[model samples]
Target: MMESAFTRPVARPLVVFDGDCAFCTASIDRIRDRIRPDVDFAPWQRLDLTALGLTEEQVENAVQWIGSDGGRASGARAGAMLLRRAARPWRLLGTVMLIPPFSWLAAVVYCLIAHNRHRLPGGTLACAFPGPNRV
Candidate 1:
């Protein structure tokens, strides 16, 4: 639903990230470096999430990935989807997530990070909202 610079009709997944969070930005940068050149990455904050039927609270709570058919994945599912799109070794890593124990572990980790992101060192006060000081 979010618009991106690289949308293709050929059916590839898109990653929607928190652009304002330094940690999220860094993670996305790493993912971009590893993924196939065609995968799409966009800032959820900059895009019109409401148009996408996603609330700001939802965007702030977790990373999201929209599959080719418009299905949505969140948290660890989103992470695995991203790795699967990266090809080969990364795909292998993503596949490991399908295992029950590992999948649960990944989900727990993702939830922890997502819930406490704002308290993390590089995550504090990193919002796209304009303050009163802005002209």
Candidate 2:
């Protein structure tokens, strides 16, 4: 496995994902296997979305990263935070992804992946987002 700061409990940030999505779960599993961050994973269904100031639609659309200080990052920002916590090379890559043009592209890619996830490997028809809603 890769050795990194995240291998230990650096901050124990929470990664809230869609439990209803097989694709999302599989992706998370793959990330765990590769990075092994000392992060806590929880399904959106099992968490208090209201307490987190989140709605079902929000989580259904993208992954969420809740920092220890209560800072929140969603979509590509969340992905970047997770990747940046991985080993050195990955951290550098993550940093690169956060730059202007790359960041914009990453956000677009993240949205595309999320929207079409149900059609991807390990995903079912139910894995699609339920659309937006008012909080």
Candidate 3:
């Protein structure tokens, strides 16, 4: 049986993403396939950023994570945390991503993609909404 969102014994990390960004959505989907089933997926657009203790500007900048203890992590740090929550090989990859040079590179890559995602194949204005119109 699937676990209840509130009843899962372990504290599930929450991934706050851009619901309108096709690339971000697809990336989250891929990450979901690799991570623990308990992790939560929430769109920043649909959620109250303040409730998550995040500012609107921060959400627009990058994905964020709300830990069980209410600690926050953003950008590559958040990505690495999510990957580590996944199992095995992915965990190894997350570890590598945490390294100095690799982490720095990952952050830059994330920023570039985030800034230019609208021009990518799956990215378009329609992706901002949920419907068949999305690319």
The best candidate by TM-score is 2
lDDT of 3 by residue, 47-128 (tens): 7565556886687678898777677788888888778777888788888888999999989987777777777778887443
lDDT of 3 at 90: 77
| Residue lDDT tens for model 2, 7-102 | 333256788899889999999999899887666778888876777678877787789987776778999999888887788787887798889999
Model 3 residue runs over 4 Å out of place are 1-10, 34-38, 126-135
Q: 90 in model 3: Cα distance from truth in Å?
A: 0.7
Candidate 2 regions exceeding 4 Å error are: 1-11, 131-135
**Residues 22-124, model 1: lDDT tens digits:** 8788777866775663467788867767656577666767788877778788889888877887668888888898678999999998888876666665666
Candidate 1's C-alpha lDDT?
0.73
Q: Indicate the worst ten consecutive residues by lDDT in candidate 2.
A: 1-10
Worst 10 residues of 3 by lDDT: 1-10
Q: Which of the two, 1 or 2, has more lDDT?
A: 2
Error of 2 at 107 (Å): 0.7
TM-scores, all candidates, are: 0.76, 0.85, 0.78
lDDT of each: 0.73, 0.81, 0.74
